[model samples]
Every structure is written in C-alpha cells, then in structure tokens.
Target: MFDVAPTELLLVAVVALLVIGPKDLPRAMHFVGKWVGKARGVARQFRSGMDTMIREAELAEMEKQWAAENERIMREHPPAPSLSAPEAESADGADMHDLPPLMVAQPDIRPEPVAAEAPVSEVEEPKTRGQGEHPL
Candidate 1:
C-alpha cells in the first residue's frame, strides 16, 4: 500500500518543503492529519469488535442447534396417554369396558342465504342537440 508514485509524491513534497520549513509546514501538516485520524478510528473500532464477536458466535451456534433439535423432537414424538374418568374404570370398578365409544357429530354451522341485490336505476343525461340533429 505504500506505492507512492506521482514522482514519488513529488519527491515527498520536495523533502517535506525542505525539512518542514515553510514556517513549520502548516504545523507539520496538522500533526500528520491528527495521527491519520487516530489510525482510522482504531481501525473502525477493531472492525466493529470483530463484527460483534462474529454475531455472538453465530447466535451461540444457533442456540446449540435449536437445543439439539428440541431434544430430538421430544425423543421422537412421545406424549399421548391421558385417559381420566378414573382411567375409564374396568377392573371390577363398575365396568365402563375400558372406554372406547364417543361419537359426537354435530356440525351444520348454518349460514347460506344472501342473494337479493338488484335496485340501482338512475343514469340518463345526454340530450343537447335537437335542432335537427345531424352532427355525424
């Protein structure tokens, strides 16, 4: 990056105007432009703190791979044994024959009656040439 060329930057500005002399060469080029703007603001804050620690280590490795894929999909789908009414009685507990009969069908959800919309007549206004109408 130090390939200075325009005739070696005009021979380093004629040897820094003959060893910084034009009355202190504009305060030595304003102290080398304030230390090259504080070394480019500390290299842009160390490249945004190494891009925020690489996006927090890639969001903590995608939350530990989404918590190990939600614990392997809850250990391969395991959750359906609820039964309740006293576990559907049976062992000489006044028998409900280990429960398995619940039907339930009611779904007609009635709502289909909407066809009556024809009443909007009023648009006749274009008759202004009756003096032997012939403007073809």
Candidate 2:
C-alpha cells in the first residue's frame, strides 16, 4: 500500500545509514525487522478475526432467510387433517374391521434362475522369437 519506489527506498536506506552510522546500523535494522514482523502478525490476526465475524454474520442471515421462507411455505399450504380412529369411525359410521387392510397381497416377482454357461477352452501360447521364429 505504501507506494515506495526503488529510488525512494535507496534514499531512505542511505539516510538511515548516515544517521544511525554504519557501526550500529546492523543492530538498528534487526530491531526494526523484529517490530515489522510483530506488526504483520497483529494485522494478520485482525484480518482473520474480521473474516470470521463476517462469515458468522452471513450464516445467521441465511438461517433467518430460511426460517422466513419456511414460515411462508407453511402459511401457503396448510397441513391436511390426520385421520384418527375416532374421527374415521364418526365420519363414515363404519367399524375399523370394515376397512380394507393397509397392505395388499403382492405377486411373487423373483427372477428366474439362469442356466450354467459352457466352460471356456484353454488357449495355446505362441512361440517366442528365440524359439526358431521371426519377431513380427
């Protein structure tokens, strides 16, 4: 983000060398490097925390949308009335025994047995080039 050109960087380095002096420049640079590393670490942590918060917010928003949609759908299509034993009897004036069984008889649908296949014959190996034969 800091638009530092090569010339600008060279100028800064020359000024630092002159101000800090060559004898203590190495130590000063090391100290600056350590602080830069720490700053970068903090920035990375902050970015990750922001990302996590954003993702959580998105998830919560999606959940709310889903709930609203579910409510809308439920309102649009009401549930059908369930037929309890008493309700069924009162409505039709018929006993439970008079009703047909829930499950109907299914026809046997097993597959037919397949006939055994003929055994395959063994193949003969071709002669190699070394056995008085020319290679193709």
- Which candidate comes out best when scored by TM-score? 2
75-95 per-residue lDDT for model 1 (tens digits): 999778886666456567765
Local accuracy by lDDT, each model:
0.89, 0.92
TM-scores of all predicted structures: 0.36, 0.62
lDDT of 2: 0.92
Clashing pairs in 2: none
For model 1, how many clashes? 0
For candidate 2, lDDT tens digit of each residue in 59-81? 99999999999999999998889
